[model samples]
Target: MAHITLPDESLPGIVGLFNFRPETTGALQLIAETLLRGESSLTSGERELIAAHVSYLNNCHFCHTSHASAAMAHLECDLSLIDDIKQGFNQIEISPKLRALLNIAGKVQKSGKEVKESDIEAAREQGATDREIHDAVLIAATFCMFNRYVDGLGTWAPQENEAYREMGQRMAFTGYVRYAEADL
Candidate 1:
């Protein structure tokens, strides 16, 4: 159970649904879908990885578990890689560009002021376009806000692995932004 009462359907909004209101939940849901869940120039798996890493740094268990599951589904990798990423993607076998992006994301999670020019230069050297770097920073910064929101409110997470797996599978297709079909 959540620390505060909220409608079941609006639970996914995390902090945005704290007041048990509809308008705030709807708006936040739209942003989550468009930014985190939708197709972007960056791969879904990579974006989810960024989100998970930032959440991990922020110590937001709900975001970490949820996005980690989504990343696993999209990357088609074993759970070990997820653990590896949670530990330190810096040593993981991802592309240099991705490593650079993850580095930038890490800084964003720590503090936006800490993101240095050297980070950009490293990513640029790895063939990351400015847009990719920009997106990475944005994803990291946004996830920091999200992590605080979920943790601050003490949002309840679904306890079962099956539920997260099913959500991950569905999100690999539908993304974070799209609302469930009427039948759902």
Candidate 2:
């Protein structure tokens, strides 16, 4: 159970936050859509991975699992890939550009100031665009706030991983901004 009584059980994990402050949903969705689903060189899977990574660093269980499932659904849904990413993307054999961006995201999760010009340059040299780098930073920063928000309130998060599969599929099919087909 959350620190406060939520509206309903349908709203699981961080989604329950909306119960207390429904007004913020619109704004939050806008940012999520723009950063996670907006046009960019980086794929939606990659963006979700960044969010998951930041959540992992923050030790926010709900955000990490939920976003990891979303990332997996968007990509190949490769459990191995998601596992490797959560563990440490550096050890994986992903693209150098992605690795660089993940590195920067990790830094941002710790402290936005930790991101250096050299990190940006490295991402650029590895073929990441300015928009891609910018998106990664924003996603990291946003998830940091989200993680804290979810954990700060001592909100309820379903313990089972299977619980997020449905939500992940919903997000993958209908973009975050689209509500008609999405249970989210």
Candidate 3:
């Protein structure tokens, strides 16, 4: 059960939070739009992977599954790579730049201050541009906040993986802007 009364119980996780704080949904969507969907050195899939990784680290099942599905949708390859990333990126077959960026993201999930100059340097050395590093950090930090927001509210989350895959297809097709209206 949710910690507060919402307009509907069917709206799961952050969707319920969005409906509860209807005013912030647009702004939140804008942020997500900018970070995950906007043009950047990082592909939409890569950005979503970073988000999914952070959610996994935070143990936020709703976000982990949602972003993982979205990541897979945006990618050209099979979903197993994403599954490996969620488990741990180190042993997975991913780019060195991505690995570096994931390292930084993991650090940020622990604490923003935990991210150091060395981390930034490492990413750059691995071919991550300044913009990529910035975006990765932002994505990590944002997801951490988002994860807490959902869990802190004791929001209901669907356990079924199929729901997440459906959500991913819709999100990949339409983006976050439409989600608030269609779902909430």
Q: By lDDT, who's the top model here?
A: 3
Please give, for residues 24-88, the per-residue lDDT of candidate 2 as tens digits. 77677777888888888898888888898899899888888888888888886554455676668
* Candidate 2 Cα deviation (angstroms), residue 81: 4.3
Cα-based lDDT for every prediction: 0.75, 0.81, 0.84
What stretches of model 1 exceed 4 Å from their correct place? Answer: 9-19, 37-39, 90-92, 158-163, 178-184
Question: How should the candidates be ordered by lDDT, best one leading?
Answer: 3, 2, 1
Give one digit per residue, the lDDT tens place, for model 1 in 129-181.
Answer: 98899889988988888887787777767654455676677666776544443
Q: Using TM-score as the measure, what is the rank order of every candidate, best first? A: 3, 2, 1
On a 0 to 100 scale, what is the lDDT of residue 18 in model 1?
41
Per-prediction count of colliding residue pairs? 2, 0, 0
Poorly placed runs, candidate 2 (over 4 Å): 90-93, 178-184
Question: What TM-score would each prediction reach against the true structure?
Answer: 0.83, 0.88, 0.90
Clash count in backbone of candidate 2: 0
